[model samples]
Target: MILTGYLHQQLAAAGVTRAFGVPGYFVMPVWHAFRKDPQIILARHEGGAAFMADGYARATGNLGVVLTTSGPGVTNTATGVASAYQDSVPMLVISGQGSPTTFGRGVFQESFLLDRSASPAALLAPITKTALEIVAPENAAFMIDTAITLALSGRRGPVHLSIPLDQQQLDIPVPPSRSASPPTVGDVPAAPCVLAAAELLRSARRPLILAGWGSMLARAQPEIARLSTQLGAVVVTSTKAVSCLPRDHPMLLGHFGPGQRSDIAQAVSSYQPDVVLVVGASLSRYYANPLAAVLENAATIRIDISAEQVGFRMRADIGIVGDAREAVSALTSAIAAGGTDTAAEPDCSAAELVSAFQKRAERAALRQKPESHGMPSVAGTISRLSRMLPPDAVVIPDAGNHWLDTISLCRAGRTGGVQLNCGVGAMGWAIGASVGMAMAAGQEGAAGRGPLTVCVTGDGSMLMHGAELTVAAEHELNLLVVVFNNRSHGRVRLGQRLDFDREPMGTDIPSIDFAQWMSAMGLRTFRIDHADQVDEVLAAALATRGTVGVEVLCHPDEVPACLRGWIED
Candidate 1:
């Protein structure tokens, strides 16, 4: 068999069952090889393809693969790749390149070569863990295997490979039988770090657990819950790691940071815990800075996959450098062995959490019943939908003012999670990502009936990549997309008005009825003009199969207060 066929075998053997991309001239060789093999979900744009791959990886906890023709195709993946890099999602990008014989002869799709200083590899290097090219057909297996390994290993992120058409087509000896790959991540450090962390939580007057992305990547929710219970610690999460503790877990207060509601931030900041345990979160300015009053003088135990990010901002009283699951597991075991005070009173912070949540719930209840039949509150709309959706529905929120409302008001413990792109803050990431997630979920169940996947997006995001919705229709994937049509780049408009103290420019969107637009894409559509209509319309959309869209009319000015904090801070 040729190198292309063998490469496909290797990927499949490694459990990479799906790929996302768009076809073009330079990639015909790949298309011919993949004609009926591991399916490639066609995307409207190269950027959307990468986003789909990222979403697939996030949903399945596997390596995501994306292929694109060289030149413009390679460049178009910039936003998606960078978002994956920042969010630490494991992904592989395959860029089809021009033949070696055409080096710099101005080939039609000449994207990269070792000789060019401004090549595509150079452009993508900073965003990828590695950017390599297949120089010879014989090295194809080794190179592809290496890319997969790097993408799945510690501090997981993306890797890029550029394959020349001739190299992919050349006949080469089939590589020897595949050997089992090495462990994806290293083992936890020996018991000293664990012991110190255990002792701190065991003896502290007040202990708090802050779970974040690392814990999610580690799949250590059980371990985290165990530790929280053992120490009677109040738990909070970063925006990226909101699902780290099941939403229903008693110890879980809420996520605290830029994308989360301000009440949780106020609670954590005012609680003044004596000890802080941060799992898998970098605690960047957005997350850490908000709770400065809590962490200011507290002893911290930091566990993270990356050593560089463990004590990135605040000094750690004890730092464990390893996978979050292993580190958290070790801590839990040690705490149990040390004899936790099971009879002790619950942490004071937990009561504070209940108070904060009660206040938010009361406000949410009031907003749920707006007196006038005017536009519904964005948060109220999201809160109502959160209650209606099943516990397993995968909710993805795009970046916009609507996103702020969704993250802040959308109740957690859904298990499917309210997934968002907290990295590059890309506008339409969820729109494209929903397709990949729906496709992945569908593969695990009946073809068109998987976990109900929903994308909550703003009109601006819909305008950017709404074309990808057609892919959902083409595949008959179960999906319901909600468009919070505030009729402008809502976030930016709010920012300009609040921060700049000036008239908004280019933020106002021309009137375009998204319900009509979604219908044009062959999706069942629902238009929501009143607050009372939300439940009825959303229920109708959820009941339908394939792709369905709900366009909610929102008041342009009403947005979360934290939206202003995100802009000025």
Candidate 2:
């Protein structure tokens, strides 16, 4: 069997039903082999292909696959690959390279340099968990299997494989058998560390549980909630884990980080916990560096699959290297067995904490009411949209002030409902990502029926990859794209205004009629300038078939309140 056929069979065996890419000469052979297998979703750009794959993985919790060709094709995918790397999304990037025999011949789109070993593999090495060049056809199966395993391993991330054109077309006498599944890491933590953590939580007067994306990846939401309830602790999530705990969970204190809402910030500042249990989070600066300062005096028990991530950005009093779900379950059981210290002083009862949180949330809502004049506020629109959407709707928010506003307003009712490109902070991701997510969710019994897949992006972001909307329309995907059309890069302008005290330059954008463009692309389009029109237009868009694009004219100066505070500070 040929190597190309073997590769496709292996991908199918691993449960990959779809692949995204832009076809090129180097990869034509493999493309032909996959013509009948794993439906290929043609993308307008290699970057869009990679972003689509990234979105598919996020939505389905499966390894996303992207195929591209040599030179510019592979280079174009760098941004998307980097974004996936930063977010720890599992993906396999297969780039077809010039033949190994023509390494120094300077063939068409040759990626290899004359003096060094620098090639597409080398270029992608830094951003991927593993990067390999398949020089030998015999090694294709091993390389493919290894790349797949590494992508899904601890601290999941993308892997790259550069296959020579000749190697891809090579036909060996016998095809290699499918490799065994990757070895699983044990979920149990060290006995001594678990005991110490249990004791600290059992005796602490004020305890907090901080969950991150790792918890969501581990499917540890139930364990986290159980632990929070048993220990009478408040739950605060990282931005990436916003939906790990339901928005209305009694013990939920809301998200913690730079983009936290004013009310959540107040609550986090006023209610200082004596101990914080950090689970499955990197404690990165995206949440703000001050998180470490806030918990400086508190006992911190950090549990993560990666030992390096245990004390990545903050000090950990007790570090446990294990799977989030298993470690959390063990800790809860240990705490139960150790018996709670009933005599320990309670700083605030669970009921009192919940009441305080609800009051703060109410105050925040009142403060965020849209004014009677000017374009609609991004936060206010998101708040209303959150209420209108179904409980299990999946929202993919792009990076920018728009996303920051979403973090403060939108609430995810179910786990893994909100997918944001926070790690790479890449614009234009949500546009293509929403298509992949909608495709995944539309599958029978995949995410249940009638679950809306929505992409919330800014004008700049929409223009970057809005071409993918055609893909959604062509596939008849159930997707909605809400574009905040502020006619400028609001975040960049905000930075310039605050940092340099200068009027924005190169930030303003010409007003593009996105509705018209989307309509031409066969998608239902709506253009609205007032908040009053939002509900009706959104309902109409949702009611329409396939994909819908809503272009909302927003105030350029309407920055997220959280971002405003950061700039002021």
Candidate 3:
């Protein structure tokens, strides 16, 4: 069998049915392999291809495969691949390199002869878990298996494989074998550590649980829920892990840190948990800094699959290195074995805590009257759209002020429904990611003829990868993109206004006629301006078939309530 055929077979056996890539002469063999087997979704740019694969992996919990040619193709994918790396998404990137025979010669798109730094494998090594260059056809199988294994191992991330065009096209006799299994790091934590953690939880009157993206990736929601319920502890999720539990859960205290509502902040500070069980979370500044001062006196027990990450960000009194699900399950079992007693007369019940938090949030929302002198307020628009969408629909918010606004207003109703590249803070991610997410949802058939993705991106972000809308139109995907057209980099301008108190330059951009542009590409387009028109325009866009774009003309000066809290202070 040909090497390409064997690669296809291995990928199929590993449950990879779909891939994303841009076509190039060097990667023609990859196209041939994917022609009839694993379906390949075409992208306008290699970066978009990488983002699509990243989104597919995040949405499906499967290995996302992306193929591209060498040189510019690989370099173009750097940003998306870097985002996946930072977010710890498992992805396999296969790049077609120059023929093995022409190693010294400057073949087309050959990076080695041009510059060593330009080599795909060399450039991706820093970002990917592992980057391998296939020098021989016979090494393809081993390298492929290794790449896949590394991708699924602890601290999962992207892996790169630079295969020469000749190697990819070679016909090699290979023995049939099963796909490589994901690496299994032993789940058993040191018995003493587990006992100590249990004891800490048992002794603390107020205990809290912090869940992160690792919890979601490990599917530890059930264990997390059980542990939180058993201990009567409040659960606070990172922004990326907002979907780990339903927003309506009684024990959920809402997302932690700078963007938290006043009610949540007051409750957390007033309650002042004595112990915090940090599970599968990085405790990075983005999620944990604001709570750091508050949790300074709390005993912290951190659990993570990566040993290096266990105590890297926060001081951990007890650092347990193991899979999130297994570690949480073990702790739960240990607590039960220890016969830990529940509080008879606690300071407050979980129900009471939740009620107080909700009351505060309601008060805050009431105080935040729509400030739309004429145009639609961003917060109001997001709130309305959140209510209009189905409970299971997926929402991918791009980076910038819009991301902060959307997260502040939108409640993620379904587990694992909200996907964001908060790790890299990359703009233009949501557009390509939405395409991949919609495809994954469509393939799953769970949405059932309804729109699967609603992407909220700022105008600056939309313009970067807006061309991918053609891909959605070409595939006839049920996707709706809502662009906040503020005609400037709203985040930058806001920062300048607050920090310098001067007119901003380079932040402002010319307003593009997005509705006309989308319509020209065979998509339904809606132009929204006034606050009163949001509901009608959104409803109409949702009802339309295939791909639709809704451009909301927004005021550049308007900032979300959450942002105002920090800016004013």
Candidate 4:
């Protein structure tokens, strides 16, 4: 058997029923195995394939798998892999490479695949917990196991197992254990530090919880909520962490980003609790803006899986190096043991906070309307799309101006609906992710439901990997892809329009017929030129079946939702 066969078996045993990729000569052995496996999903672009894996991992919490050919194939997927790594999603990326014999000789598409693995791997390493390459076939199982262990370890993330083409072909002995086991989480120490931290929370009258991406990774939401309710803490989020708590949550403060609720900021500023508990979120200036100065006097407790985060820029009174999920559970148990149950819930205050924040959001949306000046604005467009989506539909967001705009218009949560580019903000991520989300939803099978997945993207980013549209049609995925046709790089346009004082440059590009392209792919398509046409087209697209796409042609000058203040006058 080729090592590829053994790798396939290992992945199957690891519960990876699907692998996504584009095939090429360098990766033929792995591709052959994938084809024979009857489980892999062959995608059109290497980037799209990786994103499919990303969506799978996001939906199932299982290790998503992706494969690619060498050089350009692998390079094409760097952004997607990096996004998975950054977001700490568990993924296994196996890219075929030039045989070790040609690695340094520059034999056709050959770069330093192994020696230089650490460089790109380093970039991903900051984002990922571990990365490696397989030099020999015998090392395949070990590397595979290692990748799984690292990916599901302290901070789950993407693991690269770069296998030379020769390695993929070489038959190797099976290791005693074929199935990869996730790494074991070490015992979290609940020392005097945790006790003191508990005391801080226990004593605080108005405690506020700021959960970040780390908290979600730690599975700290339930525990954090328990602690917050007990302590009367207001819970807010960093930009990417909006989904950790329900946006409709009474105790939930709105997201911390551009166009965020002014009242949430005011509440945070006004309530300025004596104790601030930050779990898994980096204590960056993004969340602590204007409030950074206020943090000087407040007691801070930071717990994260990444050691670097514990003392990155700010000093924490209590810092722990345990896994976030474990640490939170331990902290929650300790608080519970301390007779921390409070019969009096802060329901009334939470309701007031949510109401105040919504009012501010409404006012801000109104303020942005006048700035549109007849152009189709991102904020308004997303607002329409959000309403058009079914109550249970999954929204796939890629990274770019359009994605940022969608965030402002919609609310994402673990309870479902919005799935964002949380970790890495990978561009060209939406189309494939939409397919994955659609597949997952279709598997659930509810009668009378609309399209299960909706993808909102920009024209420029869509072109980057637009070929994936064919894969969606081929897979018979019922996905609704909405393109914001602003006829330019929306982000760059925003930058040029704002930074250059309205003398925009290098941002304008001629629009291509995206809807036509999708239609040619044998998928249903719709084109809309104005904001008024969006809801109607969206309704029709959702009503129609089997991967319908809508293109919204808008003015290039319209600013995205969050950047209106900075990007517009």
Best-fitting candidate, scored by lDDT? 2
- The true-structure Cα RMSD of candidate 1 reads 3.2
TM-score of each: 0.93, 0.92, 0.93, 0.87
What is the Å distance of residue 148 in model 2 from its true position? 0.6
How does each model score on lDDT?
0.79, 0.80, 0.80, 0.70
lDDT of 3 by residue, 240-357 (tens): 8877786667788788643566456566777788888998988878767768866688999999988888868677899988888888888898888877455233346656887677
On residues 31-114, what C-alpha lDDT tens digit does candidate 1 reach at each position?
A: 667655466888899999999999999888888889888888888999999999999999989888888888777778666454
Clashes of each: 0, 0, 0, 2
Q: Ranking by lDDT, best first?
A: 2, 3, 1, 4
User: Which segments of candidate 1 are over 4 A away from where they belong?
Assistant: 35-37, 113-118, 173-183, 340-373, 443-448, 561-569
Lowest summed-lDDT stretch of 10 residues in model 1? Answer: 364-373
**Considering only N, C-alpha and C atoms within 3 Å, which residue pairs clash in candidate 4?**
207-233, 218-325
- Tell me the tens digit of each residue's lDDT in model 4 across 1-569: 56777777767666666778888788788888876532677788888988888887877667788878767787777778888877777888777777777756657776573544423344344545665878876667777667776776766778887777788888777756564443454447457778777777776666667787777656566777776666667787777666676555557766676445444556677765677887888766666675575466688888887777788778988887777666766777667677745423333455476567666665555454412556566667677666556666677776667777666767654444567775566667887777666654543233224447778888887778788878778767767788877788877767765787676677676868888888898778898776567567777877887777888777777666665452222
Better of 1 and 2 by lDDT: 2
Instruction: Please state the error at residue 189 of candidate 3 in Å.
Output: 4.0
Which is better, 1 or 3, measured by lDDT? 3
Report the number of the highest-TM-score candidate.
3
